[model samples]
Target chain A: TAGITQAPTSQILAAGRSMTLRCTQDMRHNAMYWYRQDLGLGLRLIHYSNTAGTTGKGEVPDGYSVSRANTDDFPLTLASAVPSQTSVYFCASSVLLAGEQFFGPGTRLTVL
Target chain B: SQQGEEDPQALSIQEGENATMNCSYKTSINNLQWYRQNSGRGLVHLILIRSNEREKHSGRLRVTLDTSKKSSSLLITASRAADTASYFCATDQYSGGGADGLTFGKGTHLIIQP
Candidate 1:
């Protein structure tokens, strides 16, 4: 199995530009999450989906939007990228709600 | 914020030394988990300790939880250079919180100097 895969391993985006970060999991996990990691700040939840077709706001969901249309993919969209949004993004999946989460390699986005 | 907080923002130790990282959270939790992230890599699950349990171990890794104190500690014994990485402690809140997502801490950067 591929586990979880995130697209665009690295990117440089200009301010106010829009982009989508793709995440896919072959584990058929019922839950998927998007997190951004900043230096010394830890990982902050951007958004999460319990299952396909539904999404929920996380700790820092202001500049991001997520949609879970199917079980295999959940993508995060940045409508207007800001320099503050420059961080490493990670996608994770878990079969059991309370089980260990499997993470993707991560996408490093630099918003200039 | 219900984010977990870890002590000793950074640590540097010689090989074979034991490295301990402590995490403290505000709310009640059903389980606490430890994860390690090597530089430029995704996180790997290390161990999980349930609230009802006080201590758990796996190989050279030992974890302890004190619900009353709302804190947990992860100890890596006989550390090696390969063990140099950032360690984070996450908690699955006792409130059921609806989504079952873990709130992570700032993480402790551990370096095992050879």
Candidate 2:
């Protein structure tokens, strides 16, 4: 079973361009999250969805936005990408709020 | 800012030896989880221990939680080359309502030499 899957394994975009990172989960989880991993900084949450149609801002939500239109998809968008936004983005899903999360392979985005 | 901080930023150990990493957090949490990530890859959940739980084990992984001290430790026994990766400790901060995201530590880079 494809527990979680992310699209566009890697991408390079010019600053000021818009991009969307796709994340999907087949586990039928109730909660989904988007995070960015950087060197020495660990993983920082960008956005999260408690359930379909509901989203919340996370620790680093300034440059990113997320939409949870359906139960299986949670896509993160960078309306105007910046060099600082270059990082490995991960999407995770959990059966419950405090339960263990399962992460996707990740999408590496480079803003130049 | 991160809620948890992992000690020994890096560790190198020979195969068959044991490796232990510690994590300290600043706030109350509903649970703490451990995850492993290979270079340039996504994280894989290893284990989770709740606030009231003291210790948990999964195969070669042993996790201990000390809520009083707001700290946790992950121990890997008989480490192998495949165990080389970055380990992170994430905390599910306790909240009154709504869903909460996890706060992660800087992580420990473990290198298991064969």
Candidate 3:
């Protein structure tokens, strides 16, 4: 079913460049999330969508933005990427409140 | 900032040995989940224990939760090299429409030596 899929598996971007990490789920889940994992640090939420057309800020949302235009897709955008943004990003989806979450393969971004 | 904290940052054990990892959280939660991540890959959901439940098991894995103590433990029986991975605990709080997603712990790097 391709539970969840993320695009641009890996990318190398120059500082100040812009890029979007794409995430899609076919499970018709109502909740989707964006998280970044850094060395020594656990995954931190970047943004989340309760449902289509609604998004909320998470713990680390300063350099990132997200949009949930439909039930199947939630994309994260990085404007003017920085070296600090170099990390593996993951997207997840869940069926209901507090349900088990399924994660995508992840996108590795390296900013030089 | 990690909501859940896993103790013993890392662990190494031989095959057939039992491995245990602990996790502690600060606040109440609707449920807590365990995930395993292999090197350079996405996390795979292992198991989930609800606040109302105290213990759960899946195959060779057993999980125990003590709400009063605000802590949980994951035990793997008869470990194998394929079980080598980093294990993390994530909590899903009732607040925030369950949309807050999971607050993950630093994780325990488990190496099951063959």
lDDT of 2 by residue, A1-112 (tens): 9889999999999999999999999999999999999888999988988899999888899989899999999999999999999999999999987589999999999999
Which residue pairs in candidate 1 collide?
Answer: B29-B94
Which scores greater on DockQ, model 1 or model 3?
A: 3
CA lDDT, every model vs. true structure: 0.91, 0.93, 0.92
Give candidates' CA RMSD values in order. 1.3, 1.0, 1.2
What are the per-model DockQ values? 0.74, 0.80, 0.76
Give the TM-score of chain A, superposed on the true chain A, for all candidates in the order listed. 0.98, 0.98, 0.97
Q: Best-fitting candidate, measured by TM-score?
A: 2
Q: Model 1 over residues B60-101: C-alpha lDDT tens digits?
A: 999999999988999999999999999999886433357548
Candidate 3 chain A minimal-lDDT segment of 10 residues: A93-102
| Tens digit per residue, CA lDDT, model 1, A1-112 | 7889999999999999999999999999999999999997899888988889988888899999999999999999999999999999999988865568999999999999
Q: Model 3 over residues A1-112: C-alpha lDDT tens digits?
A: 7899999999999999999999999999999999999989989988988889998887899999999889999999998999999999999998864578899999999999
Model 3: docking quality category: medium
Give candidate 2 misplaced runs (Cα > 4 Å). Answer: B95-97
Positional deviation of residue A4's Cα in model 3 after best superposition, in angstroms: 0.6
What is the C-alpha local distance difference test score of candidate 2?
A: 0.93
Better of 2 and 3 by DockQ: 2
